[model samples]
Target: MENAVLLNAIIENAIDGIITIDDRGLVESINPAACSLFGYTPGEVIGKNISFLMPPPDRTHHDEYIQRYQHTGVPHIIGIGREVKGLRKDGSVFPFMLGVSEVTLSGRKIYAGFIHDLSQQKRAEEQLKDYATHLEEIVDERTFSLQESVEALQNAKEEVSLSLEKEKELSQLKSRFVSMASHEFRTPLSAIQLSASLIDKYAQPFKSEHIAKHVGKIKNAVGNLTTILNDFLSLEKLEAGRVEPSFAPFDLVKLSEEITEEMQMVAKQNQHIIYQHTGKESVVTLDQNLLKNCIFNLIANAIKYSGENTFIEFNTEITGNAITIVVKDNGIGIPEKDQKHLFEPFFRAHNTGSIPGTGLGLNIVARYTHLMNGSVDFKSIVNQGTSFTILFKRHE
Candidate 1:
């Protein structure tokens, strides 16, 4: 009996909670660890009914379950660790794991059980589940915002393309209007000039100052009309791609001198002109009329914008493999803000509002320069002067 008591003492002090019940469902023995697991002291739970540790429905049904199991000796979850719930002495419930084993002693049945508390583990798992839900929500919100930003960018690009198409249509419309205006105004002005000439001619030689005055007005109007018409025709041909390049050997020197001489008459009212050739007499391959037009137009523009008697310089030089001609003037220069638009069709300087112009001269000259495989560049200082440099390939 002493040996049996000592062995029972050894099993009761184990770290793992231990308990045994008879096949009749009565508490046979229990350990100190089992007592601590259920909030009880040793001997306080030893012979108590095992149903005392189960909750309401389970407590009432446990005896019937044991009776059924003893009759059949069939197995369910016994002899295996399984998660379950346990009721404490204070009526608080906690999660636990349970395992049971059955044995035969003296041809009678016995049972043993192990129990583990899981309150802390349950709390940790709940916290992890909450964090996962929050992370999923954050990812969903950012993905939605990114989709909105992409949609906005696509919309902006479409708007820009539509605006560009409208601008192209407006440019073509303006060109048509200018062409129509030139045709409409030129016919009436031509009739008036012929009438004035006939009156000056075969109608008796009147020393009448009034006749001379009237004829002068007719001539002035005709000249102004012609200038406008010429500008219109040139701009139209340039824009329509009618100007073709015909390269041949030509006298750049004589062409330069002739252009300057004609432009000198036009410049007489505003500026003085000087033309100089600074290199060996050289012949270059280029279209004579186109090159002449370029020089004449440059001189005409310089003489128009400068102050009275301002000196205009026309210079030509043969440098390396190119012929460089420069047209410079001491005039009211273009503003910095307007420089970027200088070569654009119909772009004029702000200060030249009172000056007579069609606003397409530089654009034409630039196109002709490019067609001849050359480059045109200019420098201007406001209220000071402007100079344009034309570089043409000077081939032998």
Candidate 2:
């Protein structure tokens, strides 16, 4: 009597729902928890088929399953736990875990089942999935923002590097300009002063030839100053983006002759300029003023570098859309080492010892040729001679 009372107390207080069914699948008893779990009264479930608490197709197949298990003595869900849906008294359904076991009293067999609601567990799992998805989205957004920031920083670094390079180049140009000005200006200014004093001394005696000689020296000195100023001005215009080519049709032969004629006054003693033209066409379209400056620089350089009695050849050739100008001089040529820097501003050849020049002639010529869409090249042999060629496309 005491053992039976203890068993009844345990079944009544158990947290999980408890159910007992006969071998024929009839519900014989239900604990209070089982009644509340399925929204049923013990009187309503007792003596009813156990399939009443199960939702179909479990309800439809429950009786057949029990008959097969009883005949074969094989367990499908008898000793194992599984999840299944239960039908409530109000016809509502919910998930639950079930475990069944078989017991015998006398010749009668009974099945007991334990049940637990799984609603809370299912809700928690769904929340975990949502949280993971939101985290991944936040990480992707931050990674994209970081990539953009890196690219912007890279562009800023490149801009800073380019600015520094330009600053360095400007600094070097300024240093070269200052040195050239001091060296180039002092020589001509000193010559003009000396020549003026000598002219004053000869003025008291009034010798025509002597006074005329010093006056001629002053003129040449002034011309040298003009050339130097022009070079500086052209360089400034180029750097300031102010020089643009203005093309027009003109006679190549006439232009060459005119330039040669102007250079004769400054030529060395007994020196002569020989001009020649090849191809039928002597007329071409080009930036005349720029081309004239280029030719004048070449011819003047030839006269300045060569000795007395040397011949300077000026030749022009026109073929289809191309024009070529050659200036060949029989003079002390540039050394092999100095040829590479021939077009650099303020650069002078080592072989030009004591020569009176500002070292800007070739550099200015090169700039002028570029403005006119042309190229200048030269070949030189030490102590032998030098030749310069200018090639360009005809403007029209």
Report lDDT per candidate. 0.74, 0.78
| TM-score for each candidate, following the candidate numbering | 0.52, 0.50
Instruction: Report model 1's TM-score to 2 decimal places.
Output: 0.52
- Stretches of candidate 1 above 4 Å error? 1-183, 195-217
Over 136-155, each residue of candidate 2 has an lDDT whose tens digit, in order, gives 45434543543443344334
Tens-digit per-residue lDDT, 1-396, candidate 1: 999899777787677678888876778887877777788775667678888988888789888887788788863458666887878787888778888898888998778888777888888766655644553454344435433433443343344434545765644754674566566656755776786687567433434554455555556546655665666577667767789989998777887887878778766565678999977865778877787778877888898888786799999887667899999998889999999999986677898966766566888889888889999999999888999999987555
Model 2, residue 321: C-alpha shift (Å):
2.8
Off by over 4 Å in 2: 1-206
Q: What is the lDDT of residue 343 in candidate 2?
A: 95
lDDT top scorer:
2
